[model samples]
Target: MKPTGTLPLRAGLGLKPEHYQNALDAAEKAAGGGLWFEVHPENYMIDGGPRLAWLDAIAERYPLSLHGVGLSLGGPEKPDEAHLARLKKLVDRYNPASVSEHVAWSRLGSTYFADLLPPPPTRQTLQTLGDHIARTQDYLGRQILVENPALYLSLQGDISMVQLYVEAAQMAGAGLLFDLNNIYVCAHNVGGSTQDWLEAVPADQVGEIHLAGYTAQDREGDEVLIDSHGAPISGAVWALYESFITDAGPKPTLIERDENIPPFDELMKEAGQANTIMDSVARDRQYG
Candidate 1:
């Protein structure tokens, strides 16, 4: 199997169309050298258009990463052939430094859901997920990173959710795109310790890390953490990120914001914060 693409150990933001010009401008400035950008491949799976043109221009400036949300990698059926074809085209064209998808599935039969639905964690599901991830990697001719899904409810399984995630990636010779925010949300929504996820996942196998924000809602009398990528990174999640980075060193980290979009500079600021932690880690390693 082809090796997964490599990304600079730097911070990236989820590219938004509104920030295209800013991104291009930043790329030219010395300040943007450490910045990279990731996009949902589903947005650029097109023939030709102004959007594709913008992406082309951006690709020329900074290293790119494709974070896909529609692969349904954990779904029952095989990945859609047509989607893979379109994705492969973009992969070949841009040669993104990384390509990743969530462990959740969003499709069933001919119907599709707009949300990243969590899959049950059973041995059968593990086998299915491993097969799906392997097939996805084989078809794309490149290894891909599979992210853990955000959980809202607990389900019975022979193995723990974290185990399923890490083992499946190992089984398929793929990497893990550990989303720290998701784990934080899971700990609140279901019931577990984020440390369990941090310890369960092998740091060397982590190709990338995602740091996003979640919202809390008062459902009935209790509060729940929602993986709503619409707020600033919380102090708790930031602490979690720092703890992990201190031990694991740095990986290609991303600041993801998909709703209530903020100014480009604001997103860049968050990226800078992540860069700071990574920078600290780099400094420690150098001195030690």
Candidate 2:
């Protein structure tokens, strides 16, 4: 299936309860045409409530994207049909510009973990994930993007994560949601060349980009980077984002801050910075 709709190649923020009114007001004022908002469908998988009501109002004025965190697409079994049905309801109601999910599993035999647990990137796991993605798309009747997860420990996979993601997209007819912060954290923890990994990603397969913050701590005298998304975007992550846009051109980028919630203006400041970098890339491509 062809791409349904493309997100404006600009900056967006994850919708938070604290910023609901701010988002609604910005949308009403038409503050920025490229400014968009993303929400986890898992949060809105309900029949009716204030949250859904607020989402209904915000989505009317801004292009929305659904970034799912609980599908557990890479689990041992196929995606849950009941979960898919609920997700489908939200998709049909919202008609979001894009939909995406992580490349990790959080469910195991009816037990659901709060965290997105990384799956071993082995050939067998790849096949399982690809099949699950294919089934998910078939059920939703829309193409979805698969995001790379943060890696803290090495798994028994001969192939690199970039190759696994690219192959999964090809096998399932999906796109990639490249998260620069995750790449940085994973590289710091796993001991690899981040630049080499970035270069290995298929440019055409990337449909969206994610930028977030991470925390570093010393563990047993070894520094480990955590993909916390609870702070501002770090300078190094911003630099990597610029490098990615320089190579891949501009894709829909999002600033995700899930903790330590800040004022709406602060989030907008980060989004504005992303827009600036993307605008610069566009200018260079146009004139150079």
Candidate 3:
């Protein structure tokens, strides 16, 4: 297998099926620099199909990141062997700049859940997750990034979630995919400081950053923010993202919108906004 390389420090868009043609055109015009795209590997895990063909055509033009949603690394059992094999195939085929999976679990025995459920951040759970991540890296022959999940309900984890992620990455020799929207949603829902969590992240270990839209609703006589990548990014999330970029420097950032898909131009506009922030930060660092 080819060695995984670092993604360019620029803005990327989540590659949705609807935007395939536009992504390809943009990539071609960009000549494979200054932009990148990420996709859920599960969507293209097929024997033979037009989807894979579309990915092939696009991969030829732009750098790609394989963001896995079904690894279930934090589950009680080991990472599913079959699922890992499928992921390995995709990784080998694409040789993405990065490969990432959620720090949350979504599988129990043979049954799979649609949602990426948060794992209890206990010491024992941490060790299990670390072991699983190590095994996954060994299997793929490359380090994989673990992403923070959006939590809805509280759990009885002994350690703070940030500490859990830090320790997990250190234990497994992996990197982090910092989803800023998730942090905002989690902090608002659970009552904590988003900036504190952002400050706690080890800058050197962050491989990528994600920005997306979220929704707020009243539930049980209180308001909660849901990490729904359906609408445009909120102003508060944008502020948090700018703060993070200014502190951590620029990482390969992504604009994720999985639901309520908009026109390709609109998605690019959001990606462009991210690029503007990144460029402004870079300029400040360069001049100062």
Candidate 4:
């Protein structure tokens, strides 16, 4: 039972508990509110709670995208069946517009790192990831998007990351949630051109896009970019996004701010900026 279909790519926000009602109200008012939201499924994996109730209320009106932080799909072994079961339950209950997880794995042995960690691009790892994605899609009875993770260090691997992602997408019948910021961060940390990576990845497989802020730090007299998701989307990443969207066409873009969240109005302002860019590009295409 593959997911019935993907939600239309439109501007959206990450549904935060503190701003749930605000989102609902904005939706009701038909204000500058975004058309949908992406949430970390792990947050709502609970048996029951007011959180679920709030999500239900807003979801009834606006579309939803379930973004999972765990699952460890890139692990050396199969994905966590229990986690997949919980995700499937969420999909069943909410009938969300889309579901996605990161390309990085988080668990090893019995311990969880609580962060999206990287894996080498080895043939073994690619096969393992492809299998995991296939199993996840089968269990959920729907398609899912695998988001690219920000790289922090260089590792010797079996295959190119783009090839691994493409193969995984093909085998799993999954989509790609192309995160512009992640690519920029990875390119900054490692030595690769963001444009080249963009061209290598299968654009048609990208069903959604994510934009977020990052932090710049220096280590060993070298610069490193961290996917903090804490600040505003940077100009360089915005340029990259513009180039990609110009030809890839607009996909549902999200403004992600997980930490140091400013007021709702401030975030909305950022979303508005993205929406404006998308609209301008779309209008140009229609008229030109």
In terms of lDDT, which candidate is strongest? 1
lDDT tens per residue, model 1, 142-257: 99999998898888889899988998888999999999999999998889899999999899999999989998899897788889999999999999999999999999999999
What is every candidate's alpha-carbon RMSD to the true fold?
1.0, 1.1, 1.6, 1.5
For model 2 the TM-score comes to 0.97
Clashing pairs in 1: none
| Model 4 clashing-pair count | 7
| C-alpha lDDT of residue 34 in model 1 | 67
Extract clashing residue pairs from model 4.
Answer: 1-141, 2-142, 3-142, 9-252, 121-158, 121-159, 122-158
Give the local distance difference test score of model 2.
0.89
lDDT per model vs. reference: 0.91, 0.89, 0.88, 0.84
Model 3 pairs in collision:
none
TM-scores, all models, native as reference: 0.98, 0.97, 0.96, 0.96
Q: What is candidate 3's CA lDDT for residue 39?
A: 97
Task: State which candidate, 2 or 4, has the greater lDDT.
Answer: 2
Displacement of the residue 123 alpha carbon in candidate 4, Å: 1.6
Arrange candidates by lDDT, descending.
1, 2, 3, 4
Error of 1 at 75 (Å): 0.9
Stretches of candidate 2 exceeding 4 Å from the true structure: 2-5
lDDT of candidate 1? 0.91
lDDT of 1 at 279: 94
TM-score for candidate 1, please give it.
Answer: 0.98
Q: Write the per-residue lDDT of candidate 3 for residues 212-284, one digit (tens) a residue.
A: 9998889888888889899999998899889989977888999999999999889888888988998899899
